[model samples]
Target: MAKSDESTVLDSGPFYHGTKAALQIGDFLTAGFRSNYRPEIVMNHIYFTALVDGAGLAAALASGDGDEHVYIVEPTGPFENDPNVTDKKFPGNPTRSYRSQAPVKIVGEVTDWTRLTPEQRQQWRERLAALNADPNAQIIN
Candidate 1:
């Protein structure tokens, strides 16, 4: 593992680790806000971080962290509808068409897996292995 002076070591085996992994996966996707809505308005670049408690996750990630590095994914469109139509109005508006936007999907890569402490790596590996062993494992909350 190539150690970088900038990196700091954190504890392993907490629920935060899984949360971090999931958020890291989400951040890998480059789909930023695409519209000019207040929520989608550009403020700065987005990154992901994790918290041990789900409430903490909701608070820290949804609210501005010290670094302004986290984002909370929320529903911005209808839950169900025809893909061909954008905005589904009453009887549908023919002139005012709203294009359907694709949901963001992220893929994660452990760029410095070897850099992790032995214990940290082991914990992560075990967590991942357990999930793989049982696809039904409720890893995400």
Candidate 2:
């Protein structure tokens, strides 16, 4: 990985990752929040970080994050927390807490989908065409 003077990316392991708005640069600096410790709720796991795919991440950002850097993070072992916890914040039932064993990093900045390059647009179009061709693919508005 190319190391910039600002920061460097570190690999944890084959795990899930999530994206959250950089509420502020301090957002990434702060430790992750877990649901298990909440007094009102039954404790599940100690260290939980939410993980989502590109589409899910986009939906999450649209629901809240906005124009901010999305912190992509993954967790390691200590499988104490339930990684599949349902998030009440957004529809479609996206997972909330994933277990993170390593420090999180600023992966990329979020921007409008129209900002995609022609190459990216073409690739997405091809992928969409393939999905549309699949009889089992559900077309939702």
Q: What TM-score against the true fold does each predicted structure earn?
A: 0.22, 0.28
Cα lDDT tens digits for candidate 2, 70-96? 344333233322223322223332443
lDDT of 1 by residue, 1-141 (tens): 111122223212111111222354454323253211123343222222223232232222232234212223322222222212213223432222111133323343322221344575467556656655674543110
Worst 10 residues of 2 by lDDT: 1-10
Instruction: List the pairs of residues colliding in candidate 2.
Output: 45-80, 45-81, 49-98, 50-98, 75-99, 75-100, 75-101, 76-101
> How many residue pairs of model 1 clash at the backbone?
1
Give the per-residue Cα lDDT of candidate 1 at 139: 16
In candidate 1, which residue ranges exceed 4 Å CA deviation? 1-47, 50-115, 138-141
Error of 1 at 7 (Å): 32
